[model samples]
Structure formats: structure tokens, C-alpha cells
Target chain A: MTIQTLNPAQRTIRTVKPMPLARNRFERMAWIFMRFSGLILVFLSLSHFWLQHLIVGTHQLQFGQTVARWGAAGAPVTIENVFWRLYYVAIIALAMLHGLNGFRQVAYDYLNNRGVYRGVMIAATGVIAVVSLMGLVALLGGATIVK
Target chain B: MLNGLVTTVREGARYKGESNQWMWIAHRISGLGVLLFLVTHISGMSFSYFNPKVHEALIEIYKTPLFSVGELFLAACLVFHAINGTRIALLELKPEWWSEQHKATRASLLITFVLGAPTLVIMAWKSLSFYLATGR
Candidate 1:
């Protein structure tokens, strides 16, 4: 006895749908950036921790120590000072961006309403931009370096 | 209820080669861990702009033995998350490297181990010494 197969016309022919590309390229870039910046931040922040907390000890993290290392005043504008400033800039920028993107992801997941989502995104961006600018100013401003 | 819990736990214990899923979970956890640290750090660092005396006091409090131990845990999470994240970013962004994703993952793990072992030792040494000295 031979088995009978279904007719081609009666058989189901399903087309596989392609995965949807992310709607917001900026958000996609931010997602990719969170991972990239996070990797760099781990090295940066951990080394900073080692130097500030472990090596020098947190008790020694006074204004004088910070100013001497990072402050632009009194300290000559030497290569080391410039390097330290750049380093702070990198840390501040990376941490702020990465953390903000992570917050954006959380907001998207939790806030389903479109208006609320838009508001959250705007608020997060504003906060991150303002804080990052303030941080840069505080870090680079020579005024904190008391003579 | 107990049976259901046991069944769920047993199912979770089995790994069927879903590397991406595991990486995603670890990335989320590590991201959150770093964010938690960031919140405290940002607030603390801001104090530098304000009253220096209060900043110094806060720093002194953090110098306690407990925080040293916490730092070790944070370091571990940060190291793993960072390494794995780098691997994912490279694989996703660089189409040429997609074929070598497995190799890249292994390499990332090796790098994480190499970097993390020293950090773990350093943190352990610091914590132990602090605890021994403080007897707290």
C-alpha cells in the first residue's frame, strides 16, 4: 500500500517574516554605545577606584588631593594636567551616556504609553546633557584649585 | 507549590547552549550593578563642589572595611560585564567578525580572567588588611 500526500494546493505554505529593524537608529546606536562605553568605563572607573580608594585610601580623598591631581589652578598646565583633564572628561562622558541609555531602556520597557515614553526620553536626555556639562565644567574649571 | 518550584529550578539548571541568552542576562545584571554604583558615585562626587568638610567626612565613612568588601564584588561584576559587552559590540558592529563570534567569546573570557584575577587579588588583599587592622 502507498501513502498518499496532500495536494500542493491544499498544503500550507508559510513565509517566514524577517525580524524588524529597530525603529530609532539613535536609540539603536545608544544601545550599541552602552555596551561599548560600559566596557571602557569598567576599566576607567575600576582603575580610578584602585587609585583613589585602594591605593591612596579613601580617607586621603580630600580636596587637596583631588585638586592637586585634577584641579587646573596652582598646578601648571603641564602634559600630566592635560592628560588628567582628558581622563576625567572621558569618564564623565562615558558614565553619563551609558547610565542614561540604560535608564532609557528601562523607561521603554516599563512605560507603555507613547506620550509618557516620549516624556521619559526627553527628560532622560535633558538630565544627562545638563549633568554631563556641569560635570565637565566642575572638572575642568580651574577655580576649584585653591592656591 | 514545592513541586512547581523544584521543577522550575531543575529546568533552569539545564543549559542548552543558549550563549546569547546567558550573555544578555549577565549584561543586564552588570549594567544595573554599575548603574547602582554610578548613582552613589555621582552624588558623592558632587559633594566636592559643595562643602569640602562634608565630602571628606563621607569619604572617611566609605573607608570602612565593609565598603572594601563590597568593592571586590563590584569589581567582579564590572569585569565580567565589561568583557562580555565588548565581545557583543564587536560581533554586532563588525560583520566581518561574525564568523569568529565563538572564538571572540572565548578570547573575551580569557581576557576577563587575566585582568580580573589580579584585581580580585588586589581587592582581597586590601580588604583583608583593612579588616585585620580595624578588627571590625
Candidate 2:
């Protein structure tokens, strides 16, 4: 005299999972990348703006001024110089990656053509690579900051 | 194409959303502006390595009134984008708080204005006074 239950005829429809339509790991990584990089950038970027724009006047901003901050052109490298160079490198690298990824996101919104989107991303990547390398060479090249 | 992203989130893009739509639009616009500036900016910095003369010329252009004004605008974009981004990250961390997103958006904007305005004003004053003095 036990109550009995019968099996359902078919699988019940599941509720839609609340997740972005990330087609692959890269897409998921990109989503997470924005958040993490953005978190760091919130401090790095704003302080940088304050430093460059507020702390330093427009007229005072010269090529020599920036290079001098990185390190003396011909003087021995100090720990502070290495620190500034690394700080700049972090900002440049992270900002480029974060900013370019954002640009790509917006581009994808308007660019429905897959081929065109791919081409644009490729070009963007090239610019990021070249610019980042250039920044590295400018900040760390011709001088041994490690010493 | 832009409709879905600017208009909705989490829900299917086809659905109409509320004022938070503006935040999405603002983030994209500000981010794009920053990106464009970054390209030219890093290029000029790097040019300091490969080409010193070119870098000096580029830096000179940056000191012009127009570019200084552009610099102010860039600061605005950066500040807004940073605050707004923090809001987005916070909401993402607590998905349930997505219900209060519009409130968060307003707060973030308000905070941005409070913090960013004084700095921007000071920057503008500095830029103007310097240009006046140097006549450059």
C-alpha cells in the first residue's frame, strides 16, 4: 500500500542558464580579462591622468622631461629609475591591451561581416604589438636599467 | 547593430531596457575614444626611441591649445569610464545586484563628477595659464 509514481514520458525543459553566449574559452577569457584589467586600470589610469595632466603642466611636458623621469640619458640607473620604467611599461601594456580589446568589442557590434571583423582585429593586434614594443624600446632601450 | 548592446543586457538583445542603456553606450564611446588616443600616444612615445626629432615634433603638437583641450576631454572619458567600469565589475561580481543596476549607474556617475570635476577644472586652468604665459 505504498504510493507509486510513474516516470515522465520525456525530459523536462530546463530553464535557460544565465550566461553570456561565450562560444569558446577565449571568449570567456576575454570577458574575464576586461573585468580584471579594468580593476587594475581604475587606479593605474586615473593616477596616470592626475600625474601627467595635473602634476605636470602642459608647457612643462617635453620629451626630455619624460625620458629624464624614466632614467638619466647617460647616468647610472637607480632603483627608482627602474621602478619608473616598470611602472610605465605596466601602464602602457595594460592600457593597450584593455583599450584595444574594448575597441574590438565595439567594432564587432557594427561589423557583421566576419571577414572584415577578423581583418580589423588583426590590424589592431599589429598596432598593439608594434606600439607596445616601441614603448618598451623607448623606456628600456639604449640603457641598462637593470643595473 | 548597436541597438542590442546599447539597449539591453543579460536579457536577449531584442528586449527593450531602461536608462542603464546610456551607461552601456557611454562605456563604449569613452572606451573607443581612449583607444584612439592611445594609438597615437604610444606611437609618439615609441618614436622617442626610433626617431627623436619626430617624437619632439609630435610632443609639440600635443602642447597646442587644441590638443590640451583634447587632453581635458580624454580625462573626462577616462574618469567616467573608470568609475562606470567599477560599477560594471561590481555588478558582475554580485549578479543578483543587477536588479539595482540603474541605481548603481547613477551613483557611479555622481561620484565621477564629484571626483573628476575638480581635477579637470584644475587641469584646464593649468593648461590655459601655461599657454597664456608661453604663447606656444
Candidate 3:
């Protein structure tokens, strides 16, 4: 009973069997997120490498350069840099979501107890959420670490 | 009350196990691995910024087999997660685009191979080259 969804890019996919007709379609959204994030990562990673390693040259990226680039007053913050930060956050966030969701799917298939399944989802989500928040804070706390 | 406490604890453990099953298992494991590497990688890279001598020294350490093994493992985790993730995403594609989700997954794998292989090679070469030039 696999369900198919249409994408803006005109692609189609056969996914898990649709449970109820009026479900919130959360997994569908998660699936979309993975593709978009993956596509963005391709660009973000490449640009980051090109900028830090190729354009500026790897040797030149000192603390001064890093600080300058981030706090360049009005340098427009280049698309690459903005994407770099977003890429970091997005990959972490999406990876967690995709992975956790996959775990849930597997548990649903193999684990017999429905009660156990719900419990697992809650626990997994809680751990992932807390850790992700901590990671975000650490990543944003550049001043303390970078200097 | 004693029974309740035991039940609560048992339920808690069950939930943790349940949530971390399957793809989530891979996700958590890989996520943790990547995160750990990222922290070390940043710190090591920071050496160059704070002090060139230290930075070069850290880079030099990368030449050893241990570092290579770590890098290889990191690459493997990254590639695996990326490819499988893309497959899942392809499974959500519209019916008009692909008659079957499995087909989409296969195509996604193709794309993954195309991108991942070159990136891995470049990363390895660059890292090795850095170590070779500076015997720090």
C-alpha cells in the first residue's frame, strides 16, 4: 500500500503504506527536508572548500581572517559564508531527524509491542532535541572558541 | 508503589531502546561520530590560526596511519549516511516523476557515487599532501 507524492521538481516516489487518509503527513515533510538539505549541502560544502582552501588559500584562514569574514561590518556576508553556517546547522538537524525517523520505521517493523514503539519514539526525540540544542549553542558560540 | 517505580524505569529503558532502533541507530551513531570529528577537526585547525607552529605540528600528526584510519572511517560514515539519506528522500518523489520509489532510490545512489567518490579522493589527497610537505 505504498503512497506516491508529487514534488515541485516533477519527481515521484513510492513510500510506506498510507495509514489514515487524513494523517498530518509528517513523514512526507521529513522526506522532502532530506532532499532539500542534501541538495544544499552539495553546494555549501563545495563552496566552503573553494573559499577557505582555494580562493583564500588554506594557509591564510587564521583567526583574524575568520573574525574579519564574520564581522566584516558591511561586507554583505557573502552567500558562501551564510550558507556555510546554515549548512552546518541544517546537516546536523536533518541528519538527526532522518536518522531518528529511520530508527522509528525499523522499530515499527520488527518490534511487536505498540506500547514499546511509542515509548521509543518519545525517548529518541527527547535525546535528539536536547543534544541538537546544545550543539547549536556551541556552534554559535564562536567568540569563546575561535579566539 | 514499588511496582510502579519498577514499571516506570522499565518503560523508560524500553522507550530509549525503541527510539534508537534501525536507521535512528545508524543516525545516532554516525551523528555522534561526525560530531566528535568536527570538534577535533576544528580544534586542530584552530592551531593554524592561534599559532602556525602548533598548526603545522597538528597537521604533521595527520600523516600517521592512525589519523588515516580515522579519516577513512569518517569518510565511510559520511558517505553511507549521505547515500542512504538521499535514497529515503527519493522515496518521497512524486509518482509522475518515477513509477517506483525503488527506482528513484537507485538513481539517487548513482548521483551519490558520482559526487562522493571524487570528494573523498580530493580530501584524502589534500590531507596526505599537507602532511608530506611539512614533517611537523
Residue A131 alpha-carbon offset, candidate 1, angstroms = 4.5
Q: Which stretches of candidate 3 lie over 4 Å from their true place?
A: A1-87, A107-123, A145-147, B1-67, B76-91, B97-110, B133-136
Q: Model 2, range A24-73, lDDT digits (tens) per residue? A: 66778888989999999999888877888788865677766666677645
Per-residue lDDT tens digits of candidate 2, residues B31-117?
989888888887777776667777777878888989988988888998999999999998998999987887898899899999889
Give the higher-TM-score candidate: 1 or 3.
1
Residue A108 accuracy (lDDT) in model 2? 81
Candidate with the greatest DockQ versus the true structure: 2
The lDDT per prediction is 0.70, 0.80, 0.56
Ordered from best to worst DockQ, the candidate numbers read: 2, 1, 3
In model 1, the runs with Cα more than 4 Å from the true position are A1-23, A35-43, A57-62, A72-79, A110-134, A142-147, B1-17
Which lDDT tens digits does candidate 3 get at residues B9-46?
46655765442234445644555565456546655643
Q: What TM-score does candidate 1 reach? A: 0.72
Which digits, one per residue and each the tens of the lDDT, describe model 1 over residues B1-136? 1343354347644756466556665677677787667666655665565545666677777778677677777777777877887788767778998888678877987988997888878767766776677785
Point out the worst 10-residue segment of candidate 2 chain B by lDDT. B1-10
DockQ of model 3, rounded to 2 decimals: 0.09
As for DockQ, the candidate ahead, 1 or 2, is 2
| Every model's DockQ | 0.24, 0.49, 0.09
**Global Cα RMSD, each model:** 7.1, 7.5, 11.4
Error of 3 at B58 (Å): 10
Candidate 1 C-alpha lDDT tens digits along A26-106 = 767777787678668867987886687567765445667776666544455667667777998899888877877777776
Rank candidates, TM-score, best first.
Answer: 2, 1, 3
Interface RMSD values, listed in order for every candidate: 6.0, 4.1, 9.2
